[model samples]
Target: MFKSIAHSLAALSDRFFHRANIRLKLFYAMLALIVALIAAINGAGHYIFNRDFLGYLNEQAQQRMEDMVPRLEQAYREHGNWDFIRGQPRVWFELMKPAIVEHNGVVPPSGPPLTPSDLTGATLRFSLLDAHRQLVIGYPNIGPDARLRPLLLDDTIVGWVAQTPFENVIGAIDLRFQQSQFLAQLIIAVVAVMLAAFLVVRISGVLTRPLTRVARATHRLAGGDYATRVEVESGDEVGRLAQDFNQLAMTLERNEQLRREFMADVSHELRTPLGILNGQLEALEDGVMQPDAQTLRSLKSEVEHLNKLVGDLYDLSLADAGALAYRQTDMDLLPLLRTSVQVYGERFSQRGLTLTAQLPAAMPVHADGARLQQLFNNLFENSLRYTDAGGGLHLQASLQEQHWHLVFDDSAPGVPPEAMARLFERFFRVESSRNRASGGAGLGLAICRRIVDAHQGSIAASASPTGGLRVTVVLPARFEEQP
Candidate 1:
């Protein structure tokens, strides 16, 4: 039995706290408890305080009756002058009305003295009784139901004042006063309980207002409204949590922007080379251009560029999926840098440019050799393609800390400072004024970036001191051996 009760209470508490919808259950429950408590307190106070008020009124009435008793006794004993007592308002009106009796030439042992004030509208009854308890003088109006107050001298009854009909006596109790007090107490308790209930519900609403705001913001977010953020004015935990949520939403929005930009860049890069190849093929088939060696060579070059672009796109997809394989091996950094420069040396020389490579003798680095070679070749090709005629390009390799640093600086009118930030972004080209024919597919640096990143390294571009572009590559000095 006890376990069942505890389980029910626990379930009630869970519903109170965890239920998402506000159907006014808690508010109603709190209001009811507050009202009940207020009524109990007010009821107890009313009973305690007003209990004395009724007693006081009843006591005052009793005291007035007691004070008038002596005056009535004196009126009967001194002179039998009932007129003196009847004429006095304090005695006759407040206490009782006087009654006159005839003695019938005999002294009575006792007689009724007076009638009560409540019997003023009724007929007065007079009676004179002899010492033997026999009535010597009696009025026919003296009914048996009359209430009589007896006059006494030395313990002997002289006469009596009688009021016929008991209705007059019963009316003197004055119960309306008690009823009024009770009504007043009830009114006060009801008003107080109602006021208390109102205040409890109002305060509960104020407390839960923050929760309501948070719920609204969450709903907006669920509808794909990333801009919705909770702005709480208080410094409470809810306020802090709201601030944190807003920050998280902002971060997610930024990441989504980056993702969109990356995709656009990828599409632009792939489409440019494909468009050139398609146009060249259509021209050849239509006989607009002869199938000469030069036209065929142009077609072959565009096709090669398209192939590289597709290959880089494929590699990026693999990298994003965390499926890019890295075959790590210890190799000399200088030989790799020298080899990249050698591959591009003939092309640079043909363009009236100088290719210089500065390498430290035998600095060994741990990396995937094939991927590292690809990284250098991509960077070199970028510099070679963008540099002006007769410009000089520099390649350097050295050990920096526990890592290898390979850098390329070209003295071409390199990428503009404004465009340098996006140089490594896929499909981003710095030469905005250059048309598609001049600007090769722009995925070279992006491919370089992914290759370097897969090796757990960094690559970025800066404005070279030589008034050209400087590309830097930093790779880890050691590697974890593959199992």
Candidate 2:
């Protein structure tokens, strides 16, 4: 039964917590805390004040009784027994009058002598009793709650003085004061709670505003609105988050633009070759063009262009999916570099450009030879397409602390510094018109980057000292056999 009750309570608490928003929870928590603190302080203050006030009243009553002791002794010394003062109500009342003691041992008048009627409504009430406990004067009925103090003369009990308990009257006054203070404090607490609640709500709104904007922007982003952005207003973590969100949106926008451009470029490239093939076939069928070697060669060239485009697309797709095939081996890079340079040297010469290579005897690397060849081929093709006639191309290789560094620098008309950073982005072309004339598709550098990355290497492009493009390749060197 206890376990079930506990479980039910826990579940109820959990539901309440889950349903309450952060702002409401914080406001309620702070309000409850402040109220509890004020209640505790007010309760303690009232308790302490009442205790001390009652004690002070008791002390005053005792002092008034003590002052009457000396007078009673003097009155008894003059008159032999109770006959002199027994029937004298005025004398008893005068003896009971509260007196003030001064520094010079002089008894000053406290106030006008209190009458028997005044004692009824006083804060401290008293009764004077004879030696036999009979009421001589003052209040007739002494209640059980009254404190009794004996009047002594020469260590002999002559009579007794009884004081009414101060608890009732002082408590009434203390209660009135306490109630007034409680009401005032309650008002102040209400105002404080309201102000605190407003501040809490304002602060929570400020904190959640950026998050709300990010959430809204995310929804817009999902709806294909990549241009959505949020305003950044502070230097805190939330502001940083907004900045990141904006950056992500900007990147998505750029990628979307690139995607559209890639599709258009692909369609155009395929259409050109397919259209040429269709036109030539139609011409042949209509006998508009003879079935000569030139006509056949032109058809073959278009087919080859279509095949190359399809293959390049396939390679890029595989690379994107991380499914590209690689047959890595420990091989000397010098042979591969020499062979590629030799193959592209003629093409460079045909373009009226000079190609030079400064290679080591043998630099070993752990890499896929075919991919390396492809990477170098792409760099060479880029130079062939972009470098003007009479431009110079230089390839140099060196060993640099566990890595082999290969640099390809060409002469004249280097890429802009800003554009150089984006050289390896797919479908980026510095000279769009020249690329179309050269029958180039601008995926070469991107593929080169992918190949180098797959080999756990780095590739970068910069402006060469000779006023042309510079491409640097770094590959991890294979340690030679110690034998």
**Which candidate wins on lDDT?**
2
Task: Name the lDDT value of residue 110 in candidate 2.
Answer: 61
* lDDT, candidates in the order shown: 0.67, 0.82
User: Mind giving the per-residue lDDT tens digits that candidate 1 earns over 193-300?
Assistant: 677567667865776687778888878877878888887778888788788878877887777787887788767776777788889889989989888999889888
Q: How would you encode candidate 2's per-residue C-alpha lDDT over 1-483 as one tens digit per residue?
A: 999999999998777766786776777777888889888888887787668866666666766677777777777767746677667778877776645446488655766655333444432377777789888767665788777777777788887878776664456776897689878998989898988899889987977777778888999998999999999999999899999999999999998999999999899888988998999999999999999999999999889878877888889989999999999988888888889889999999999999999999888888899998889988888888888789979999999988999899998777777788888887778763334466467788889999999999999988799988899999999997898
lDDT of 2 at 234: 94
Looking at model 2, residue 342 earns an lDDT score of: 92
With candidate 1 superimposed using the best TM-score fit, by how many Å does residue 311's alpha carbon deviate from the native? 1.5
